[model samples]
Target chain A: MIDGGYQGKILRVNLTDHVVKEEALREDWAKRYIGGRGYGTRIICDEVDPKVDPLAPENKVVIATGPLDGTTAPSSGRVMVITKGPLNGTIACSNAGGYFGPMLKRTGYDMIILEGKSSEPVYLWINKGKVEFRDAKHLWGKLVNESDQLMREETHLEAETMEIGPAGEKMSMIANVMFNGHRASGRTGVGAVVGSKNLKGIVVRGNLGVTVADHDKFAEAVRATREILAQNPVASGGLPLYGTAVLVNIINSTGSMPVRNAQDAYLPEADKISGETLRTRNLVRNEGCSDCSIACGRVTAIKEGKYKGEHGGGPEWESIWSLGAMCGNSDLDAVTMANYLCDRYGLDTISAGSTVACAMELYEKGYMPAKDAPFPLRFGDADAVVESIRAMGEQKDEFGRLLAQGSYRLAEHYGHPELSMSVKKQEFPAYDPRGIKGIGLEYATSNRGACHVRGYTIAAEILSPGLDRLAYEGKAAVTKFLQDLTAALDSTGTCLFTTFGLQAKDLAQLYSAATGFDCDDKEFLKIGERIWNMEKLFNLKSGLTGKDDTLPPRILNEPIPSGPSKGEIEELDKMLGEYYSLRGWGKDSVPTKDRLKDLGLEDLS
Target chain B: MKVLVLEPAKCTGCRACMDACSFEKSGVFNPLDSRVNVITFHEDLMFVPTVCSQCETPYCAQVCPTAALVRNTTTGLVDFLKEKCIGCKQCIVACPWGSIRINHLGKEIIKCDHCSGDPACVKVCKAEALTYVEVEDVVASKQQGVAQTYRRIAAEMVKGVNP
Candidate 1:
């Protein structure tokens, strides 16, 4: 009996039996967990076995959209996709923003649970209150763009779709699920899990309208939130003008750009692959997700040169860092081409580029011979980066196979596990942990393997320049608070970028107005803490311990060689004890029974 | 006279304009219900906003059998009148831009009516992709763009011969 801000329907599709079941969304769960990532993690923890193979039929993939979705709330377009990650063997909660999320919500369901594996390639077509399992043999090997066009043609409707490309079909661990053909639920190998289910795509055409509890109150809350977003420089000016790639020169200047597979922290030619360069040379225009005032999505083009006419949504800040500085490639055109191909082939650009960087390091170290690679692999080889990404997407050869296993395995194969620059079998994003100590702690303690979005301390540490990023003293508390807030925001189905301008109180106001739930600031933060602990409980049950909450030896031991943070190693251990204590976790990094009882997560424990 | 103008180059294809238009017009947030459409050319890395040109001789108004589509003299917009609409969709078939859409309940075929002169789409367009400007200014701005391209080519030619 969900009242407002919810469709009150949970649609579960069992691929094995081709059965579609509609069940009542639990009101208690909705009130407690909210929705989106909260709904996903709880459902996955209940349904999936800890020891089950991520790609196995027993595993379930839950797609959850929160109450604010399909509403006029600014940037409330994010959709969370939760599953066991094939890459890191951890609970994966990946969020993607685009039209697909709103459309999915409009289908009169708050969540869609995908269960079992289909024997043949198939796609789910969900219209308003009706679900159909359609044959997708024709769309199996097609890339996202092509498959999207095909699906639209087949459906004869302007359907919002989430599709996978060749990379996912081939089961690349770095594969990502693409929404609206470009925006992706990218991290932790969610696409590979979809591939394992033999699901080609999910096309949704929703005609029903989403209604609010009190339209006037909701509108006022949205107005206040949008006003904050409009006034914030990062949200309104820098983001809209330069997209996320605006961080390139700034992060590079701080010596946290992670150049040449963390061998160096700065790229000499950083400006060449900067947001300023992209705006002047390659920018087609700035776009945004549905109802997003901060149009941070870059539509860029390679106007001339070798990779001429190549264009796509981005190589955002992280992608640019992974494909450019980290690989020592300064050519913006090459980076843009790699970005397009990654989107086209449905590959996670972060893992794809980071793995290539690892291989480049292996090649330079004389560990990976030239004969083993399709071409001579070297740092700053722009064309090599472009081709290798395509090769990895297409699973080109033995080289492609090696690259598909991701950096951890690739570096381990060369007998240098420490050189992989990863944690928990997942590659780290652009930020070098050594330069930003708070980020290092966040990465180590992140429930998911190494990821920046889980808790983006960069906003305070480097981007805002408000905090002492070099000192690790009070960062643990900051990191833990951010992580909880982020987890809660992820549950609310809003883009994490909104935090740049609006605070938890703003979102809480919006939530209460939309759903008629009377939640104060304390209750809001508590909900976030509860969600974070629930995820930790799931991980603990899955056999992850305090020992697993750690960064790689390179990030912890190696001093950043150049730039502002020169000769500084990450003090992760200094923060871990505080972080664990603050999180109400024991010395083993597991939530104690008493702590779980406090959050009402004792059942999960 | 002023008219809604679209600069495809300025569009990021975020669909904020679409969402706002739909919400304002229909009291709901749905991209498909928006009067304006954003056509994404993903491979080419471009977004072309397809909006009502509000032409002098609108095909939609001309094709409407019931005179539901009539030009509003004040705003120079071909506004839709719900009372006169027969739900025949003749205007939908005739519009070249495909900007007209059937409302969620399938009652009226609605297009951009400029919201009685203060267009919601234009008001929310952050990229300035959609604007309401005098008709002559639109052509003047376009010509300036063309002139700049020609001037650049001419300068290049002069440099090539002189050097």
Candidate 2:
């Protein structure tokens, strides 16, 4: 048995055979991989075949949390859902913050591996050591909030739930798995994989405690880090006061907000839908995830519009941009309503809004037939924005089904795939790569395709004092370093926001105290480097190559039309080769055997 | 004497207080063992962090068969003595607010002792939802909060008439 930070059990559920078995967690693998994304990806790489279809029964979903989960370590409540994603058939891992991760840890298991497919719709109810597979046929078509309530009524009242809505039920490629009906594992169609298995959701509750190896040391580490976070202006002041929507004004001022499907990089009236505006008009209160002190979550309501009384958790910075500026709509009410719809229907807001923006462009350019659209699909039409979200969520019509396939497929069908503003068939987020150069490199090299959280170079390029947003020099090394560090941090079950105040050494201190492992900053970062290489190897085996590592043509070729970054374009080619060299990859962007062996992955190579 | 004051509007439902309390009491992190609990009503967007009120006429102390639950006059806290108690669970059943609960192991009763007069929950509460302050200061601060709201309303009235 392990000393602490692990329950030493892995729960494996085979839906096909209806078997629930408890397997001992591999101690050696736990030591090396750590947990969450790292350990979950290791299991996937070992058990799953790269060539298998992502929606097939052979594709397994590993729901994992790290050693810090359930501990008093600040914001240590993130859970990762790792699988062969249906979005691009890549190894996808999406994490969300809530009570689910800590509750799962209390269930006497470090991870839950879901295998095979069920003949009928079902949900898993895990109460401490007991596991129950219950029929969910009656609840199959319910929305996220309704299903969450129903599942909890069936199980314990206090049980934490993770479920999907109609998007997942229909296996939309941009589906999300929502926890507590609000927090989303919101990328790369992990929800579609869950739906393909005919599993509706999982409810978990337990009474066990998570013990640390050194209690005094862990407490001291937590106290120090908490003080640091409390003192940091971004963490304690801006975030709690205005929420992440604060970035709307900050990024817009920098001319990187990606307005109107990235036809332009800035919106002149951006502050109308910014964080400050949201707070003054719509905010009811601030909320937070479990164990988090920096409560950046906005509990907002539309008070006096047609969508009045519609309230929910957030339309955070990315969602605000995607639904507001990307659609060329300055109506905050419409944006907030659409954000609620995305969460309720279990859709990834970034992909959903971006896809709609592409459709609008297609319609406006006369590429898409007027007969194909239910109404005039024009930019800045608030009603159309709301209607389109409803259509995509419910799949109400033929046009809705087409839109649900995501922007890449939708744009390709319209005969101008270049208009999709995406990389590797996944849509770009709020930031325009043309304005911010380092983030462009990150999006190109991201294992999960065009994701911001994989490596947020924006922290360096825009938020912090390190790098210039418009420059191409020195971006390669920063991107690589941030990517590696992020890979490790995501595994630790801590919020990425913590990095604003806490450094690598602080994280190492917490991890070492909890797990009884003496890890310094260098070793901690090395573990992250190992995970990055492992993910790259998985992508290579799945047939992606150096040629696939590229930004959208629009970002690389077009200059911002107006604003502070009016003449800027992303110089990705200048950074990619240097990034590859820094990562110890070959010129073709593949990890060398020597680097794999150095990371202790010789056998896999 | 000091009392634990809970301001429900300020709680974010992070449950850091619960984790701190449980760890200080049991050396492990579990909300089930926590003396303080943040009850969440997600639909209403409300969180109430509940703790023992340490009532002057303690129901738990009166109900205890062995007098294991007693009110400490110095700290104004309801102290639980494990050694003096039998596992009768009378105090658990008699608690009107349900502040007292059976341990996770179902062996004995557990209630907030205010961390022996230095509450761990208050120190870690970043939201300041839970504050341990002198009893006399609590009402004064609460009244000041209401007066500020009235002052804002009166200023708004004046501006409306002038504009």
Candidate 3:
């Protein structure tokens, strides 16, 4: 039996059969996987057929939280949405921060397994121990904010919600599950999977207390951890003051801010869309997730513009870069507006913006016909960017329909898949791999495909005690270590930002105190390695091979045009080979049998 | 006497105070069990942390037939005596700010007793949205804040006229 940090219950809902079953959480699995992404993905690997179509009825979605969730641990309110992602056909786990995860845990369940497709639109109302399938026909096509309000009204007033918007209802490949109508589990088409199941949303409220095994020890651990966070310049200063868009100018200065579909890595006017600019012009207030101290979330409004009076959660650094510089548009207002629309529409801003950037590139190159676009789809056309997002969200026209399919499909349709700036058919985030080499490898090998949160080597490559961003040497080991560490960290139901001040030992201390596990830093990272190898096995079973572990040709071939890291190109091959060896994987990037045995994951393999 | 003062403008809606309070009181983390609460107004971009005012003439103390709820003169706290509570929710209803609540188990009334003088909520609030301060200081701070705002507005008006 688990001592603490868990509700010790799992809710399995079969939509097709209209069955809601409650089972004891598998203590064995909890012990090994920890929780959140690790525990959720383990369930997927065990239950889901790797070869199953991601959007099919056979596929399942696991909504999971860690032992630390709802606890005093700093920034511990992350929810992981795990599934076979439609976007890249990979094992996808998108982590989101909001009250939802903690609220779900309070409902006496650590995880919710959504299986089979509902015949009609429906939402789950989980009020403590009781679960009900509520008809959501009225909420089917509503925006996330509207749905959130309606869900609250239908359930408890204080109920937390996770919902998909019109984009998800239409099964847009770039759709994401929006928590509290703003925070997004925003990658790899988790929302499309929900839509395919006709699951509109989930409303949860609970009054139960979450206790830790060693309460005083846990409190002490939290105090120490929070102190570290308070002292760290990035965690206490940059993040809270400027929000995440603080990275806009920082990354640009590194000459790795992907611009104009990554045709350029730098933009001279990048500061116009930066965090400092956002604060001065658009910031309404700073917001934060449950139990967070950093308060990096920005609540912004577009005042005195065409999109004036438009207010919402964020244009976070990635969103700003994708919607701003990636399309070669420096209009901060347009970017902010576009970000707000994406939130309402429940679209992944990175994918939506990057896809629009891809379309703009295609249009400029004459690959995309002018008649296909609503307006001149040119890079730097702010109006066009906003229009394209609307069209894509609504799937309004033929061009909109194509855009909904994500950049890879859209670019492939235009017979230039190379222009997608993607790995595994998912759009790359803000960073230019040519300028920052390790992240390219990370993007290429991320289990969910082209994601940054999986392993943010950028913290090392660009942030404090910086590494040589252009160097190919030592990046492989650094990338592998970070990936393993992040895999474990993401599983802990904590914000990735906490890593700015926290190390494995700090996290392990919190975990041990919470769950009565005597987990050391070394053992903690081993668990991460196990989770990583488990994901690799799942992908391997899903037919993703070492050949698929690659950066886009543009990143590998093209040198950065100009700026601080001018003439730099990602030497991916030099690092990837070393990465494979370090991971105890074969040349084909397949985890060896002996390595699996060592990690005690042989049974999984 | 020190009272729990809240600055809604400084609150980021993190609910750390709630967690800290709940853990301190009940040895668990649950907002439902917390004496302090952070109410979020998402559209307005505001968060207001609410707690027991420990009113000078407490309505909860006034309404209690059993005198289970009484204001402690020393601490300025409207303390809830559980043995005498009788599971009566009169204190909960009497609380104007809804600061008093039933325990998660619905067995008894729970309210802020100022964490026996060193408010746990205030200690955990990194944003400094919550503070335990002398009542006079709260009013003084508010006046100072208002004065600063007026000064800024006056400066802006002068700039407008000069331009």
Candidate 4:
């Protein structure tokens, strides 16, 4: 089953016919796309109809795992869920890391592709070599935790379940299928596709373990990775202790922690909602993904207060920004509770909080009366934040429905679309691109709308790659390289955080060993470029263009007003030109024929 | 009498015990198939590991239909002999604490042997939950736990519980 240590077969579950078929491995596609988000986008764009309504039953959800998956490789417990997002209305490929990917790998399938809507609410169970769809009508409209509980009861505590909550079942655009309690596939709203299919959840359990083709060599590579990571203080020392919350004070001090929905470039409440605060005050424990040593995933709980018993899928940096500063809510307990609600309801905290923020601005501006709206939905209202999150879970009432659609559509409905901090219908994150130019280019180019994790540029523009600081001139070159590197990492199903310690050459070396393909650094980088261009081509074919590559009006028009990044505006026109030129794209930002030919993609398009 | 001395505060929930037992018995890494189960009541962020006490009157070994399981004389470890085992899961049902499990997928019965003398799980546990302390020391640990609880209550007092 493994030539290069892989399951060799991808499972296709046609929910419409209740068909669970095992398909042969596509060696060529695996070679070109690698896996995870890379293969996800390629398969979706080529196989599924672009015109299929994102929320409709016809749309397909192809869950992909990479070649490195199930190995003792760090963070190989990652998987990608790809479909048309109701939030962005584009190619939504969201990646998550936990025990699920490894379990699926043990179940003897490289990937699981869910196609067509089922007759009724049902969940697919994969037990070692067995696969089946069982009735889930009784479990419909449950939260992610509730679904997990029900499935575990039915499967007798043997299965690890991945399920969406009521928000997904209701087809809420910002929904995510939470993995366990602390980790999530927290972006681009793939949960809506899961909901649309009437597939409530997927539970997998297996006793089988993977065999690395060359176990001795694989062991060496894993050890080398640990050695590299051990030196990078960020991954080994800092992240394990503080998690990604390590960025809070730094991003704030640099004026990159976007506050009050990007109107302010820094959060004054930086100390309250920071990673340090989380560690000292709220952190209950920390855990790792399958076989990972860096256990950065935080388990936090609010203790001894009104928000007592309030816990988290732990508030990540983006969650801290979106639900914390973006809404002007500083109460740490409330922020933790909001984070909990997002995971419980299986909603994306970024889109949910920013959507509510957009409405808050509108309400403040007298665009809508508070009486007509749900709560006094104003900025900095803690009660309102909690209530709005509850309403999102319920998926009832007019205001909740609007917020469920995410910020882009919510603002557009009020004829104040410019107020929405978004690109491609997904809301922008904490980094105000106007303050930092490279992130602006990255947001416009990211396949899944307004995503930062897709290609984070804060490394070069703010926190510098080699711990160097603040270089703007050569950032275009740096961002381009990192973004492609990120694309490659996602394809390989490795955590993007690994890039902090692991060099491209190491990744290339590991990739060759894992896939049984001799891919040099150039070959790897080409695959990354190919995925990026393929995603761009998917967007283009799905009716997006260079015009769409433009940032939100506020980001383009406004300066930081006052901060370290004050007087700075996004040099978008200049950066986009150079980026497109380097990417071998036309003036319209579509990949040129020459670029496709060069990347061995001529046969593809 | 022998007993498990568990320190709740020190537990990190690495589940190394499950790995060690499954590896020796099934020759695979499976937490589900392990005998000494860690009942992690995660809402409390607490790990309450349920293991065999190796009681003076062993209920499971006493009631085994095939007499497949028995308490060792020298070490008092509750060991299961696969050759003697009929795959009848009577001991699993007879045990009150649920520290026994059959292979969930393979349908083969399993239980903890505590590694004869030097227990592998106890040695491997980063948390030190499974200690191979002297049989007499178990009483002293229980006395220490009670004394600590009394100190905690005394520290918290302005008033005692009303009669």
**DockQ value of candidate 4:** 0.14
Q: Estimate each model's TM-score.
A: 0.93, 0.99, 0.98, 0.85
What's the ranking of the predictions by TM-score, best on top?
Answer: 2, 3, 1, 4
As a whole number from 0 to 100, the lDDT of residue A274 in candidate 3 is 93
- Individual DockQ of the candidates? 0.49, 0.79, 0.77, 0.14
Tell how far residue A184 is off in model 3, in angstroms.
0.2
Docking level of model 3: medium
- Taking the tens digit of each residue's C-alpha lDDT, what string does model 4 give over B6-81? 5645454445555545544554445666666665543443555666777667788888877778887766677777
> Could you tell me the TM-score of candidate 2?
0.99
Order of candidate numbers by DockQ, starting with the best: 2, 3, 1, 4
lDDT of 3 by residue, B112-135 (tens): 888777888887788999988898
Residue-level lDDT tens digits of model 1 in B1-163: 7788888877766677777778787666666678888886644546788877777788989988889998877767787888988889988888887877887767767787778777778766766888988889999988998999988888988889634
In order, the B-chain TM-scores come to 0.83, 0.92, 0.88, 0.75
Give model 4's docking category: incorrect
Residue A113 displacement in candidate 3 (angstroms)? 0.2
Q: Per-residue lDDT tens digits of candidate 1, residues A9-118?
A: 88999999999999888878887888999878899989999778999999999988998888868788899899888888888999998878888888888899999999
Return the top candidate by TM-score: 2
* lDDT by residue for model 2 (A119-209), tens: 9999999998799999999999999988998999999888999998999989999999999888999999889999999999999999899
Clashing pairs in 2: none
Candidate 3 residue lDDT tens string, A1-605 = 78899999999999998899998888787878899999999999999999999999999999999999999799999999999999989999998998999999999999999999999999999998798999999999999999998898888878899999999989999999999879999999899999999999999999888989998899999999999999999999999999999999999998899999988899999889999999999998888898999999998888987888888899899999999999999999999999988999989999999999999999999999988888999999999999899999998789888999999999999999999988998998999989898999999889888988888889999887768888888888888888888888888899999999999999999999999988999988999999999999999999998888888888888988988878888888989989999999999999999999999897888
Candidates, ranked, lDDT? 3, 2, 1, 4
- DockQ of the two-chain complex in candidate 1: 0.49
**Which candidate wins on DockQ?**
2
